[model samples]
Structures are given as structure tokens and as C-alpha cells.
Target: MSSRQRGNFNYKLAFKLFSSFFFLSAIMDVLAEANGIFALNLLKTLGKDNSKNVFFSPMSMSCALAMVYMGAKGNTAAQMAQVLSFNKSGGGGDIHQGFQSLLTEVNKTGTQYLLRMANRLFGEKSCDFLSSFRDSCQKFYQAEMEELDFISAVEKSRKHINTWVAEKTEGKIAELLSPGSVDPLTRLVLVNAVYFKGNWNEQFDKENTEERLFKVSKNEEKPVQMMFKQSTFKKTYIGEIFTQILVLPYVGKELNMIIMLPDETTDLRTVEKELTYEKFVEWTRLDMMDEEEVEVSLPRFKLEESYDMESVLCSLGMTDAFELGKADFSGMSQTDLSLSKVVHKSFVEVNEEGTEAAAATAAIMMMRCARFFPRFCADHPFLFFIQHSKTNGILFCGRFSSP
Candidate 1:
């Protein structure tokens, strides 16, 4: 070829590569924001009563639903897509590919931390799933297709799946499929498990920890094991909203915990109501935070939470997928099978060493901070989430009100 032609070819190749990178990066942002929104919405549902502590892994739940969406057809697909923000993408193919890339990205562990995520599909041995569906799951989600005798051995099948989940999560989660959660009528199940353990880049001294008062409400207070540390960190304080954010990085810069606390006089509900995908992005950006040396006091606590997600998803406009006759998952199987229930369980422990957490969610389906040397004391109710910095993937999110 001519020299000019070769030069033009090189330029075109470089441009295509650049464009692909740009596109993927944009999609990652969209997925991150969507995950954040889902997290907040789920919390809203679980906390509507506002009398209990709430916790779960939004990423795990989203991954499980995304797999379910793979088989969804017609209106069933439409509703799931809309609720999941997958409709913002070009199409189902792109969304699945984005999730595929994401699952791979976030699961890659750095030298300083362990982050593991796995997806699986469990179906009755008698059921026949489409080869295309199984292939897509294996390709996009790296999900294994396992056959169980849910028909003749309901209890055994439930125990087997629960054991698999526990093993995947290092035994941090167990009995995900409660007794009576599975029955002879159960035909298919989709599940995802995520486990993460990361150490603080700068560890808090054990000697500084002490029992401190944690204000649960206007009139209630409880003593908590509050961990104290003073260091230079990245932090953001919003005067208008009366919220403070702190970013605490793990040993590697790949992951970090972001904490959001309302002002002393402000209730957490005020900040929660204003949390949106746009606002989450705006708050986490580097430009929003200032570097300073400040004192930090955080509670050392462990929590476990479980939920029957069937009603929750239905209320979120995912009704068709859970309804027997209305459900259309033709792409997944040729049989007359629809989601009966979805269950989620998660456990989290945060201490001076860092954080260890695991979460499991079944589509029985139908399916931080901050830097500051500025005295950021988390002695009251506050919201916190662990995220992958590169992909902005929210691993786990929760609120600590009392202890």
C-alpha cells in the first residue's frame, strides 16, 4: 500500500480504539450511577418504616436480576430494563456486554484486597433450558448452570444451593434459601454471591478505640465501640445539604469506602431523600473533596440482614416477571416456569483492621471516607458504602444507626 494510505489506516485504527475506550468508560459510569440509584431505592423500601438498621449488596442483587433479564421477553423484559436503568443503553446486547465486562473488572483482586463475585443458575433436572440462554449466561456472566432435583428433592436441593453460596462467600452467608422458601413447585433459581475483604490503607490505632455514645434518635443513645484515627484524607462537606463525606482507601487505591453523615442537627432522612445518581457522582468526584488531616471516629460493628425480595421487586414495577401467567421468560426455557420468590442475605463487619463482608441473593426469581483531619466523628446514624474506584461499582451499602 501507498505511504499515505498506510498513515490513514493507522489513524483510523487509533480512532476506533479511542472511541471504544470512550464508549466503555461512559457505560461504566452509567452502570455505576444506576447501581447507586438502585441501592438508594432498595434502602428506601427497607427503611420506609425507619425503625430498623438496613444493609445489603446492591451489586449482587443487580447482577442476579441482570441474569434474569437475559431470559425475559416482551413486556417482562421492558419492565425489568426500565427499573434497572438498562433501557438507557443501546440495547439488551450492549447492556449484557457491559455487565459482562463489569463482572470481570470488579472481581479482579488487587494485591491488598480480596473481592470475589460469582453467579449461578440452578434448575430442576427435569426442566429444559434453552442452549442459547445457558450459553449467554456462561459468556456474559460467567455463571455456571447447575442441575438440581428440585422436583423430587426440594429440601436437599435448597440445602445444596445454600451450601454452594456459603462456600462461595467463605461461609460469611448461610441458609440463604430458608426452609419453605423452596418447594416441589420450584423449577429454576438464579443466584449471585459477592465477598470482599479489604484493609485500610492507613490503619487506625487499636489503643485509640473506646466506648462512645451513639445517638440512635433524638432521645436515645447507646454506647458503641468507636474506632479512632487521625490522618490526612479526602473529604467533602456540603453546607447546603448539611452532609459530610469521607473517602477511606484500602491498601491499594483500587477500592475505597465512602461514608456520608448528616450534620449533627440533621436527620439522616433529609440526606437520603436527596441522594440521586447525579448527586452521588457529583459527591464522589475528586473535585468535590479537600485533602486535610482530621480526627475520625467510626463504630466497629457487624451486621447481618435478610429480605424476601419478591414483594420488593413487584413494588418496584417488576410485577410481570413474578406473575405466573404474565411472566415471559421464553428465551430461558421452553417450560412454563416463572419466578416464585427472591431472597437476599448479607453480612458486614467493620473494625480497625478494615472491613470483611459477604452477600448472597437468589432470584428464586423471579426476580469512606474521607479524608479529613477535620474531626469527622461518626457517632450517630450515618450511611456508608464500599465501592470499586475504577468501575465505580457499589459492592455494599448500609446505614448504622445505633451500634
Candidate 2:
């Protein structure tokens, strides 16, 4: 319950947090355009039918353009919702460059994740998807570099990015970034926000999981299966949410895979929806329970996914942000400018006790599928997810039935 409220609160918080970073004009234009491109890519990946998922909030595959361009030159995040127009860059940086760079990065990281995951899990499917996205993403990034202003461009990108990510993620990830979230001692704080989630092709067994009473909320208790497992892991019990979060560290401790199991009567999906970066971080710092009784369910599932946002933006009428001829970036440099790319990457895998996921955003083009009825006899509801402890990002979201 608290997590949900917090998630709702973060929506406004995201707007306020990065609002001050850049001038209104700069932030609005760049972020809006980038978000559109992001949406377009989704059409490319999942197809037009899935538009509702990428367009709306909560369960939406969406993003905001936010970043701080820091080059030897000065930078700025303009105020105002609509983007300001700039002189055509004979070759100078363009409005789209920042978003292009952002998308490019998103696509690059997403591809890397898909490839690595395919090699380990998906195999041939990974190769298939990679082949499809490679050309598109590269072309997008190449386009962004056509006009580049290192510093100002970064500022325009970063300003709204933090806010965009914070809003999309529901604050599960306060800072959608790593060491750079709080850039050194510099007065300027540049944050990159990332929110991603996916469901399994298979789900865990609800019947197989032991159903027992759980301490759901501060005021309630109900029957719930506390998924159990004996594994070397990290976990935290959140008093606010009345749940215990278990962290299953991935290959490189840098990416932490986690699970949120509510006290009895608590809804896993409810808890999942309410997750935030602030709350997630708090969960991680918790003291570990080396050995304890837990109710666990194993789900048989897998998820295949990817996205692009160019067309979505075009639909929004931010044409100038994507093209060199149409884009505007004159404010940054005295010369011409054009967007290179705006990229984003996301991945998640889920099982009974928890999940594993990773996400990144760049300005290059970035980029997913699904279905199955199993013959297994496992009957019951199971829980699973992949969460980024640092940013509270849900890579994949799902529930399993073992009936």
C-alpha cells in the first residue's frame, strides 16, 4: 500500500526533481522528442497493435529525454514545454542529436543484453532479434552524430531525462543512473533515468508454492505463499510495504536481481506496481537473513522483447527533433547541428523466488515477443520478477499458476 502511494507520489516528484536542471525550453523539446522516438521504436519491435502498452502510463513502454551535456563549452536546459527552434546547422549540432545519442546508447546496451542473454538462455532467438535491430539502431546513431555539441547537448538530454525516468519508474529508481547520478563535486547534478519491466513466457507454479499466512500490511494478515529457497542471497524486510525483498545477485554484482514477497494477503502484483527506486535502495541496505522460513513458488516462463520511439514522437508532432533538416540545435553551437540518436535498453528474466533484469538508455535506435499452455501438473500461484536494487527498475513482471 505504501509503495503504491509512494509510486504515485514519485510521478509528481519526477517532474519537480529535474525541472530545475535546465531552462524550460531546452528540457521540454529534447525530452519530448526523445520520448516520441522511443515510442516509434516500440512500434517497430512489438508492432502497431501493442501501441496501448507503449503509449499509456503504468505498464507502458515509455521514456523521457533527460541529460546534462557537459563539454568544454557551457550548457543549458531551456524552460517551456514546446522546444525552441534554432538555425539550420550546415553541419552544426541539431535538436535530434541529443536524443539520437541517447537512443543509440539505449539500443547498443539493449542489443548487448539480448546477445548475452541469448547465448546463456534464448540461443537462436537472440541471434534472430539482433539481426533485425542491428541495422536500424546503427542507422539511428549514425544520424545523431551528424550534428553534435558535446556539452550543451548533454545538458539538454540530462535535464528532463531524470524527471522522465523518475516518473515512468514510479520512483522505484530515484536516480536512473550509476556513479554519475550525483556527478562528483560539480554543482550540476545530471541523472539518467531508466524504467523497464517484462513478463515470462512461462510462469511459476502457484500450487507448488506452499500457501501459508503472511503479514500483508501493517493492519492486515492473510493467507499467502512465502516462496522459499535455500540460496546464497541478499534480502530486506520493508516495514512500509509489509514485505520482504530478496536479492539474487546476477553474474556481475553490478546488476542485482530481486524479488518482493508480501506478508500474508498482500498482492504481489500490487506490491510490484508500487515499487520505487527510493524504497528499493532502502530494501537493499537491510540486514540479511541467512536462514529463515520462506514460502516460494516456481513459475515456468520466458519473455522476448525490444522498442523504438521515432514514430511515436512524430505522432506527437516533434518532427524537428529527429531530422537534421527538421531538427534545431543552434543554441548549443554557432554552427549547424543534427540529432544522432536516442537509445534505451532493457532486459528481465523471472523464476519462482525472484527475477533478473538490466536496462540502459542512449540516443541511438533501441529495441521484444510471446505464448504457451503447459502440460505440467503443478497447480498453484507463484511469484517472480527481476529488479534493479539501485534504481528499483522492474525488468520483467509476471505471475504463475500451477494448476
- Which sections of candidate 2 miss by over 4 Å? 1-229, 268-274, 286-295, 306-328, 331-403
Per-residue alpha-carbon lDDT of candidate 2 for residues 187-271, written as tens digits (9 for 90 to 100): 2221222333333212233334576543333454455443333222455567776676655554433344455556555544455
RMSD, every candidate, angstroms: 7.6, 20.0
Worst 10 residues of 2 by lDDT: 117-126
**TM-score for model 2?**
0.34
Candidate 1: stretches off by over 4 Å: 1-9, 354-373
Error of 2 at 170 (Å): 30
In model 2, the Cα lDDT at residue 230 comes to 29
Q: Distance (Å) between predicted and true CA of 50, model 2? A: 15
Supply the global lDDT for candidate 1: 0.81
lDDT of 1 by residue, 1-403 (tens): 9999999999999999999989888887778777778887888888776657888889988888888889989999998887787777744587777788898887664467876665687888897888998899889888877889988899899999989999988888777888998888887776766666778877766777999899899889999999887666899898767999999888767888999989889989888888887888788886668988767899998888888888888888989987778999998888877887677788777877743320011112011433323689998899888988888888888888767
Local distance difference test, each candidate: 0.81, 0.34
By TM-score, who's the top model here? 1
